[model samples]
Target: MSAIASSTSPQPSSSPGTTRNTNVTILLACLGVFASYLPVVGVAVALPVIQQALDASTAGLQWVTDAFILPTAALLLTCGMLGELYGRKKVYLAGLTLFCAGSLVCLTAPGIVLVCVGQALAGVGAAALLPSTLALISHVCPDRRKRARAIALWTASLGLGLTLGPVVNGVIVEHLSWRWIFLPSLVIGVMIVVVGMAFLKESRASRDPHLDVPGQLLAIVAITGLVYGVIEGGSAGWASPAVIAAFLVAGAAFVAFVVVELRSPCPMLDMRLFGSRAFSGAAFVMTVTLFAQVGLVFALSEYFGLVHHASTLDIGIRLLALNGFTVLLGPLVGRLMNRTGPGLLLVTGLVISGIGALCVCFFHASTDTGTAALVIAVLGVGIALAMAPITTIAMNSLPRRLAGTAGAANSALRQIGSALGPAVFGAVLTDRTLATLPAHLAESGLNPADQGQVGGVVAHVGIQAGAFLRLDTPTATERALSAYGASFTDALHMCALVSGIGMLVAAAVALVLIGVRNRSPHDATPEPATA
Candidate 1:
């Protein structure tokens, strides 16, 4: 119960060093950032392969992805605090070591359970990696201009990871094996460890840091419970005792988290940050944007693999239009923030993305790849416009001393949204497919008794609409495929509506709560903070 006030001490001064030292530091930090995010989207491209190889159910597939996201989101604030209390360099190297170990485990895992365990370990590592990387950049680059450029490069590395993950995984899964997805990450992790040990400096806050253990545990309980409930509710009846109990536990945990954070002498999350409209709005923008982006990628990757029956490489190529634009436009967006301001970019980007998401509502199984590519390209452009600007807004909204915490908070929220995107959208897709299945099956001219015979298969199809198209049974006739396609299209449309509406709502939030007034003269340049 220490009552130490948060301090705003200047960044620790580094020795006057050669330009080579700075470059190497930036390079190593960027590499760590890239490796941390590489697995986020890469796994989506390999989901079908994993599903078949591991005989994973739809829920299992979701868990495979979410297991990583869960710890990354849940432990981020705590990890960031730990980085401040201990040494950023120490926490970062430890994280890389754990990440490498997790990658090795995933590479050699014999079952889906072990794979999930491995992903969870990697997630814990990521929780330690992300904030520390950004904090290190801020610490080493004390000059405002150099710091800005360094942070921008770090942000670009994130986009690069998102962009390259799918395509690289596609190539590996198609040519080598799904297990190879983690191999490159393992190598990169080791390289970062060696380079970081030689070049990175130790940095910590001047204030005595308190680890909010109760708040951290509560966050894990809340997020895990809510996500589990959402994913399971799709299969178990929504009102089933298990789902209901999970939601209840999540609700109670969240309430407890708020209470603990509010009363703690030194909170993990300073709830007061939310009192600022601009800070809250920027966080919301990051959340909803990723909610649409991640969920769309997950759904479309499955559509490409299961519905279009495209190869993994083809799926990656198709997705290039969406992810590529984000990487390309990141720098330009940062430059534009000075002129047009983040508010305009935020609103414009969300609106454009919303339009792109809604456009998918018109897509059918026969939609050409070219048209799909064009639609996703628009989505990518919109995300690019918003992503960097949103980060700028969130970081600038706080005092310079809190930059590390701001980064951690924004990232944690974004990861929560990332976790929710798949769970919520996947639930909608499963439920809509299940609800639409019976009527479609009835219309296919099956007698009630014959339909009853296929009831078990229908349930499986509902769990994964793509599973229906993969079936070779007599029950999976031409009519059945058509019925399943219609059902899937309907479910996708519902998913689109949800994502589209979310973006639009985010746009409204930005318009009302966020403005250009907070934009610093240097376009929200980052200040020095403890790593």
Candidate 2:
């Protein structure tokens, strides 16, 4: 192994000037991450407009979103490993360059195919940008206390990006053309490149060179099969041969990944970290909480738009409760983690979130804004509490030298959770809605033709069927809503139950990680910053 792979990240000095520069470096990293994430949410809101304008197919529309996620998820570990082997600064700058190029591709692309290609390019940039920022935080704040605070800020930027992406997209789509979505990202990417060139410093890798190509290839195959199976299985019957094949492929790929990783030198992830109680526990909670929160937000957005007839602006505003508290709570949560341990915060957050999900079970088609807000707000609070400490424990569990890889692993786990949560919940809701269709159609007293119309391969019948079923008779409204209510409630209950399991996993992890003590003053000093 080369010395580059075995070395530790450089430490920044504690001097005031160095501290300021460290903050700047963190800011630049955050900006890059923020810009990368902008496209995910922004493009989603712009999708309908793009489809309308460009005559895109359903598959093309899906690709517009999936293109970003597939590459970002597949290559996260690779980017993290690259940072460890080459240097954080060089890799980070490279990511920014790709991001700029991708944004430009989207801006100038002639059709939907090219747009998907652009998103794929952006995903690569996002993969690199996400883990690098966390690694940089580990390097910049060598002291655990300051590092916790810095991570809090970094996580806050993530929330900001997600929260703002749709709002920005809505503005651009309403006033200008859909292509304008890529314009701002281009400007931001250039800014990140310029700032990185001026301020960022290169860091030495922590270990000798061993690229672990076999492990990486296996991991990619595994994740691709899994994501593909997930998206397709929901539409294709679960019992269908295609779905079964996807699952089988995914399972085989997973087994291959484990075998390859165990044998490879310098594997992308250090699987042994799972042996640390704290690392495993915190990571488990992260995946669960992310699944619950991100999945719920996705479901609710559609509910507001399709069922409640909310406009794009209205949907954005109404959905604010989901992520709004996350930004507000960052600093306070950081200070609280500094005062207390991660165990208390994580457990409390999960419990609160589980309760919030349960509240959605009581929701009706006629649910008022205040009630809706209250339900989402509870989930948001839970998310606010859970996010900070889970990260704290995950990073703090390892020795400083392994922080970069650990951060990458933690992030990959969370993204996996985010991806899975929506897939599972969406499937449940979709299946239950279809199963209840006969009961609803009979109750509506619609003719056979009308019933057929309601039955003909509707998307999200779970959400919109309630309103349409009530349109015929005023007295029928209550009974019609009852059926829809029952179905939606069943879906919510399932989601809550699943999320509760996630919470329990988090709580168990916190308990087992055993000891993470308060930082002493000496350990809180700023360490030298690394790229």
Candidate 3:
């Protein structure tokens, strides 16, 4: 086996200037990660505004979000491989440039289609940026303790972005315009480019491997098709031909992707990485974590807006309970990781988060926001404990040379979960709302004919359940409002149950697969780079 050392392998630097440069590098990488994540949650606050401005349907709003997620999730592995083959700095800069351009396009987008196109462009940029940012950190910080701290900071920056995205966007959309949401991201993108050019050093693999074009294509098709099917299944019946075809295409593409990767000499994602229990377990935990986190974020954002008639600012504030704890506790958790081992943190975190989610299942329209916030804070604590440590464990499981691939694979899986979270949760929420709407309406003392008429309106406007709640018209009757509230509450309960169940399963997986032994800092053992 040929070992190709990464150029980023840490060198001792005692000089003041070198230390300052190292700090700057970490900052720049964190900024890059921050930029990539900002859009993911920030845009949720703006969805209603965009829908109103563009006269977009619920599916259109979903596509606006999914457009970005699809490409980001699909292309992450390819971009990660390219970063190693080309140069990490070069790819990083290019991603920032594209992201800036996409932001500009979104700022000026006249319709939802244009906005979605711009989002897709940004997704492509994020695909390049996410893995490279982590790889750069792994390269610069060699000491396990220092690396863990840096990774914690990196995770915190992501949480900060996720934390700020909604609040900032909410304030902007409320006081200014939805278009201004992209402005800060645009400025940040430009600033990062300048800082990257000045301080970021170039790093790449010692030898370039063959690009896996077929594997890349298959992966993209599979992911895009699956996301499409999930999103469409909510509005278009699950049995609809279009939805069925999307699932079939996704399945076939996934099978083809596996075959191509197994055959390719230099596959984008090495299938063998799953052979390591630690690596596979970490990946599974990540997917499950994001699935629950992102889905709840999406669902609850709508819940706040639709059920409570929360202003954008209020919705953002409500979400802070979940994200704020993540940002605040991330570094502390990182510091403790050496003593705890990831297994304990993972199991403990998932269980706590599951409990939080299960608690939320009891919420109703009249439930106090304080009660919801308290439970969400518990969920946040769980996420903080698990998030950074999982990354550390996954990277440590691989050889130094394959760190880039490891980061990419871990990130790609997380994004896949992120995408699925919203799609599946949204689908379930919509289905539950439709099923329960009639019963709730009838019980509210509406005549049979009136109930039928209200149901038609719900079928049309209720595609975007949250947005439909905001509508002021005939269906906004006292009884109709009550029915919609009850229906949404029912949906929220189901969504929370699903999230809780997923976390429990993840906790079980962590116990079975993650190692309980903590590696000593002095023990420097390298695993073979088989992939």
Top TM-score: which candidate number?
A: 3
Error of 1 at 300 (Å): 2.0
TM-score of each: 0.89, 0.89, 0.92
Model 3 lDDT per residue over 1-531, tens place: 123443433323212236677688789989998988887889878887888989998778878888888888888888888887777788889989988888999999999999999999998999888888877777777667777788888888889999999899988998898999999999999999998998887776655456778988898899888877877775677899999999999999999998887777667776766777777788898999899988988788878888888898898899897878778987787778767766677688889989888888989987898898898899888888878877887777666556577778878888889888887888888888889998998898777776777688777766344334332345446667778788888999999999999998988887887855676212433344543
lDDT of 1 by residue, 1-531 (tens): 123334534444333246777787778888998999888888777888998998987777768877888788877877777876676788889889989988999999998998999999999999888877866765666554455556666777887888888889988988887899999899999999998998876766656656788988898798778767766775576888999999999999999999998877767776766767778888888888888888887777766665676887788789876767766776676566656766787789889998998998988867898889988988888877777677767766665445467667777877877877776777777778778878877998766765554556657545454344433456546666666666777888898888888888998888888865525422333232222
Q: Quick one: best lDDT, which candidate? A: 3
Model 3: how far is 261 from its true place, Å? 2.4
TM-score of 3: 0.92
CA lDDT, candidate 2, residue 509: 58
Computed on alpha carbons, the lDDT of every model, listed in order, comes to 0.76, 0.72, 0.80
Query: Could you tell me the TM-score of candidate 1?
Result: 0.89
| Candidate 3: regions farther than 4 A off | 1-17, 463-476, 520-531
Q: Candidate 3 at 395: error in angstroms?
A: 1.6
Tens digits of per-residue lDDT, candidate 2, 297-344, equal 767766666556677767777777666777788888788778876667
Number of backbone-clashing residue pairs for each candidate, in the order shown: 0, 13, 0
Candidate 3 collision pairs:
none
RMSD to the native, candidate 2? 4.3
